[model samples]
Target: MIPEFWGNGIAANPDNYLDEDEFDSSYEGLLRLSERIGDAKPKGVPEHVIHTLPTKPYLMSKARSPDERCTICLSEYEHNDWLRDLPCAHDFHKECIDSWFKNSDKCPICRRSILENKEL
Candidate 1:
């Protein structure tokens, strides 16, 4: 009787690689790997993409108080005023943020880069 390993062909040709069917299955396994690699590639931000980023750190007093002033322009924030917050936790008035983003992709106060220069 043939040994179990020989019957499976593993012992018969130990040095041989996987057959086409097995190779195909393994190749399909790389779909997610390719997707992850693609996702990791850096993407370009559109020139027209506008971000309402804050110009200063959002202090608890500024967030809670209606009379708090924006340090950028030294103007008082009024009730119901529209503001935008950045990932760095800074806050700014909407209009100020809009104008700032249009000119550059850096945080108005800290100058942190919002978008990076892509190598062509």
Candidate 2:
């Protein structure tokens, strides 16, 4: 007997079509679960990783000056503004960086792990 639909092994297999529907659902589930895996804060990170980082006031000094703006908010750093100094020595607004670290442990600019060289 001849096959009703003849082609490569996959196209000839009727089960493949049925599996495609199931596979799409499975793929969607996986995508939803990992949507935040890249560049986003993965679930289960501890809050202290952010809180433990150093924070200081943005005092106007010849030293420790800002980069003309806050990298996080993209706004200029006013006098007496707060800063969250990363382990890499890059600083951002306290509120901005703190909110950032909650989602990630790396510096937004340097991409260095804020956890680097620190005893956890």
Candidate 3:
């Protein structure tokens, strides 16, 4: 018979060692185990979730013109309306662009990092 389950709260399976439900639920347990055994620390908030500075307006000068609309809010830019440029050189309306940057660091169209990495 199986021993009474206690401590970490995960019950050992008698048959299959790799139960899908247990594996899915074991993330917190595994994290705790890693900390105890490997001296690993808990992960910090991902950079993608963190907000950063907006791209400067001058960068828009290098952006490529598109016959396409802004994918963020699905609105098109007027011929000479203010547009914000991403490091990827994609352009969007200043208002729409500001809204996106506040929520995420990725370009709405390409998912490129706007602040974590300069390579974009």
lDDT of each: 0.61, 0.72, 0.59
Q: What is the TM-score of candidate 2?
A: 0.61
Candidate 2 ranges with C-alpha deviation above 4 Å: 1-18, 25-45, 61-66
Error of 3 at 35 (Å): 26
Report the C-alpha lDDT of model 1 over 1-120, residue by residue, as the tens digit: 678766766777756767767554366677765765675544433445443333443335534665466656768776567777766566777677666666566676787766644322
Q: Top model by TM-score, which number?
A: 2
Model 2: per-residue Cα lDDT at residue 28: 75
Best-to-worst TM-score order: 2, 3, 1
Q: List the residue pairs that clash in candidate 2.
A: none
Instruction: Select the stronger candidate by TM-score from 2 and 3.
Output: 2
Clashing pairs in 3: none
TM-score of each model, in listed order = 0.42, 0.61, 0.43
Lowest summed-lDDT stretch of 10 residues in model 2?
A: 36-45
The alpha-carbon root-mean-square deviation between model 3 and the true structure, to one decimal in Å, is 10.5
How many clashes in each candidate?
0, 0, 0
